[model samples]
Target: MDNQYYCNRCDREFQNFNAIKSHYSDSHKKTLHYACSTCYQCFETEAALATHRRNNPGAAPHQREPKAT
Candidate 1:
């Protein structure tokens, strides 16, 4: 049997050896697109932003969550 590894962060799937390797380098290894100015925390997607907001009550609600992975 073969195994598969998926990136929850990027929501990408890999079936074979090379695809998984490329996915990690191309998606996971890159810097986050969204950043928290107050804490300088970086988030790869908007969903992460919402998760952070839940912990930060003072945060604005207008912030958007990244597309589902």
Candidate 2:
């Protein structure tokens, strides 16, 4: 297929790069990100939560940080 993104870990095909990246990061890597304390918002990736914090400067960090594997 043209312009397809396939996961190296699971060999799954995706139409876009973000889908493949998210799939690998979430399913394979299992890199969990803590959600915001105040609003309690969780995201699939750290960058997503970082963007949220950047947009909302008042957002407080989660009490429990993600453990390193």
Candidate 3:
């Protein structure tokens, strides 16, 4: 039977569906055109990097906010 999984982009063979999915996502999902300057993490687009920065913000080094009363 045709139970095997393969990468749609590269045609690489895989037996498990999740493995192939991850492989595709990591290897082929994005073009990797953008990267974060602070963390040097890669992203597929500028919007993604902007979103990451907005979410993380890198507020402060070794600093914390006061606990709510």
The most accurate candidate by lDDT is 2
Model 1, runs deviating above 4 Å: 1-28, 60-69
Identify the superior model by TM-score, candidate 1 or candidate 2.
2
Pairwise TM-score winner, candidates 1 and 3: 3
TM-score of each: 0.40, 0.41, 0.43
The residue pairs found clashing in candidate 3 are none
lDDT, candidate 1, 1-69, per-residue tens: 234434446555456434544555576674344444333344556777568767887864443323223
Taking the tens digit of each residue's C-alpha lDDT, what string does model 3 give over 1-69?
244654435767665444554565688863444434444444445676578678887733221112212
In model 2, what is the error at residue 14, expressed in angstroms?
30
Order the numbered candidates by TM-score, best leading: 3, 2, 1
Predict model 3's lDDT versus the native.
Answer: 0.50
Model 1 residue 23 CA deviation (Å) reads: 18
Estimate candidate 2's alpha-carbon lDDT, on a 0 to 1 scale: 0.57
Stretch of 10 with least lDDT, candidate 1 = 60-69
lDDT of 3 at 63: 19
lDDT of 2 by residue, 1-69 (tens): 565644544667776545555676778874434444445444556676677688898766546445334
Candidate 2 Cα misplacement greater than 4 A, ranges = 1-32, 62-64, 67-69
Superpose all Cα atoms of candidate 1 onto the true structure and report the RMSD in Å to 1 decimal: 12.0
